[model samples]
Target: MKSIKTKHRIIKAVSALTALVLASGMLAGCGGSSDKDSEGRTIISVGSWPPEESDALTAMNERKARFEEANPDVVIEPDEWAFDRQTFYAKAAGGQLPTVYLSGFTEMPEIINSGYSSDITEALKNNGLEGMFNENIMDIISRDGKIYAFPTMSYVLGLAYNVDAFEAAGLMKEDGTPMQPANWDEMVDFAVKIKEATGKPGIVLPTADRSGGWIFSAIAWSFGVEFMEKGEDGKWQAKFDSPEAAQALQFIKDLKWKYDLLPASTIINAEDWYRSFAVGDGAMTVVAGDYPRRVAKYGMTPDQSGIMAIPAGPAKHVTLLGGEVMCIKNDATPDQIDASVRWLKTRYNNELTDEYKTNTETTTENAKKDGQLVGIQSLSPWSDKAESLVWYRDYIEQNANCNLNHVKLYNDFVADCPAEIKPEEPVC
Candidate 1:
């Protein structure tokens, strides 16, 4: 809880201005027909995320093209994927958000809580997609007892380890090959080896005054503890003071301090988690499932990196579920909602997966070839990838997402709370 010190409530509203959400930018929603369809259906406006051309934009362009050719009268307006938490909040607060916007599974609470999204519980029920979604995504979007957004894709967390490092540290197979540690103790031992030999930080989180608390939150959750819980009154209440919670927090702190594995500086921005792991400055890093896939672009091969479930905590092995999702504005016409659904159906189709799946699957394959991962969707495609990527196949059953169960009450908690915990800044 040591990240953003400012409150969403305190944010000075950005007057209406367009913005992009992710690295890839937005994809157009429909083909040439972004207005009325051949049969005169109203043009529907949609937003794309990661804003640039990757598999997503390409797949979108292809699908939107087909959707337009099939229905000449229906125009599709695929706006840039610019809206994110702050922008979404601003639009919701000002009521300027689009009829349809896309985002992640973890974003549901913030979306609905801000009052811009509407419950499509009935629509989902009618469309037979009600059962197709995972409970985690549905739970996050539900507010005042209603479901808001629909899931688009799913993803989860895993431990990305260096295969060579594991062998070099004597933590791998007899052949000094790839494998994951069975528990936390062995995990920490390997980190120490990397530190002793490499003279680099063991595992990176964040320790800067303005960052580093996300690692704490994820670790705490992985131990089956929710740092905050909703009271009978339904408002979010901080719960990081429990014995188990304290133990989990202290264990990580000790790793940074006493054990000399996690450097105190590892406690800064969540972004460091990427740099340290991707650059091979750390032997092991617990991160999103997409970590190895994304790092492949940077030349971190499979033989050098691999992924596996985080070691089981004393309580349980856990991961924070995350991924993109779709939501239509409450005020949108029925036509808008239908159009949003049309786009979602197209994006999630197996045919589309054949196109987009490679972003991850291809990366996974490459990582595996170099010893970087087990397999993106192979671990438990039924549970982990089912409904989407959070579970992939069948990696885990019970998840720690959804608004009611245990969601981050504040976006900057990772940076701010730790600042509160010790008050003293790191020496570095």
Candidate 2:
């Protein structure tokens, strides 16, 4: 696994200073009341980065309208802001951060330790959602038994393959089920067969950006390698300079050079990789479970898409855990904080309410209308396996446009594999 550096250096320095100033201001009752509009409605801004004409943007707008209707005292504000390492400090220091924003799970520890996030322990308890979160996820955003953020969604990295390509390559069992490789050698063989059968790259790898390192880490972890580890002195150190790590990198190199199974353009990122895979230009790619929606947008049907656990390595099978955590800004007023919690609960926790049911139906219908993927399988942030399956069973059976069978292999793996948190970047 490759060690990824901290994406934003300024976050570590500025957040602590900002927190101190805000904490002092709070004692003077000076920082909390500035978030109200002239109409006296509490303004709650949400951060997102959907393109103007995208289905994601449309869905976000619809959700905002529903949230406002349910809470008359609050006004929803949409900020077309995406998290970028270069610009995050500027936005945060300039008081431009939205009341609620999406942050990567990898960033939560630093964000929490720096005091940039609001402590939402009380809020979760007050809303009766304290015990509902998946413990593995909650542990990432919590410190000293206090949670600073909400787990919005979590996903495991897996092999997303073209079902048609697999079948054409005769990579299916006698019963007509896709064959899942148990180790790297089998995976390589399958890739070669698929590429020979279909004149396309056997697999697409992200090698141009940090995602390259991210994906590499999952592959290495499966081979029992860690990018960094805490030492006996209680300080983190890089451990990737080892034989196991070398073997992992060599495997990727072999896929490109030795096996000739990868594309000549080796610098593709997520967008480019998705474009190729969705259009049937590649046999498979390692991606998160949330990729189905993007696949759908590219005109791939559920039957054409298949997902499975990342093939096991010599040591064990593992998948990388990734997701977004919802956070409130540090300087938000108590009223704003309360409002944020209520909004989260309305969206995630009140699944049994009529309002939520109506919203779900509307969302499903709109997704169908927009040709978006509905009921894609993913890790639930709010419930355990048994509860999550039961909680969304009706919605899945009724509105899913994708073939659930394509995702069954992944679902079964997640049901048993113990999820490990992404490794924190090593500090020099």
Q: What TM-scores do the predictions have?
A: 0.68, 0.81
lDDT tens digits, residue span 294-359, model 1: 565567654466555556577665555556667888766666666666565555642224545544
lDDT of all the models against the reference? 0.55, 0.75
Instruction: Give the winner by TM-score.
Output: 2
lDDT of 2 at 99: 90
Clashes of each: 68, 0
Model 1 spans with C-alpha error above 4 angstroms? 1-39, 49-59, 71-73, 113-115, 121-130, 142-146, 174-180, 193-202, 206-211, 222-225, 242-245, 263-271, 350-374, 378-428
lDDT of 2 by residue, 1-428 (tens): 11123424445455666688787765353233367888898988777747588877877678778889888889877778877756665666545678988888887776776567898888878877767887667678888989899887788787888888898899865553578877789888898999889888888878867778778878888777867778899667888898888888899899999998887788888777788888887788888877776777788776687787778787677777777878999888887888898888776653466666666677668667766556556666766532433656567666677666666677666656643444334331
**Could you tell me how far off, in angstroms, the CA of residue 275 lies in candidate 2 after the best superposition?**
2.8
Per-residue error (Å), model 1, residue 116 = 2.7
Model 1 error, position 361 (Å):
8.4
Q: Where does candidate 2 have its weakest 10-residue lDDT segment?
A: 1-10
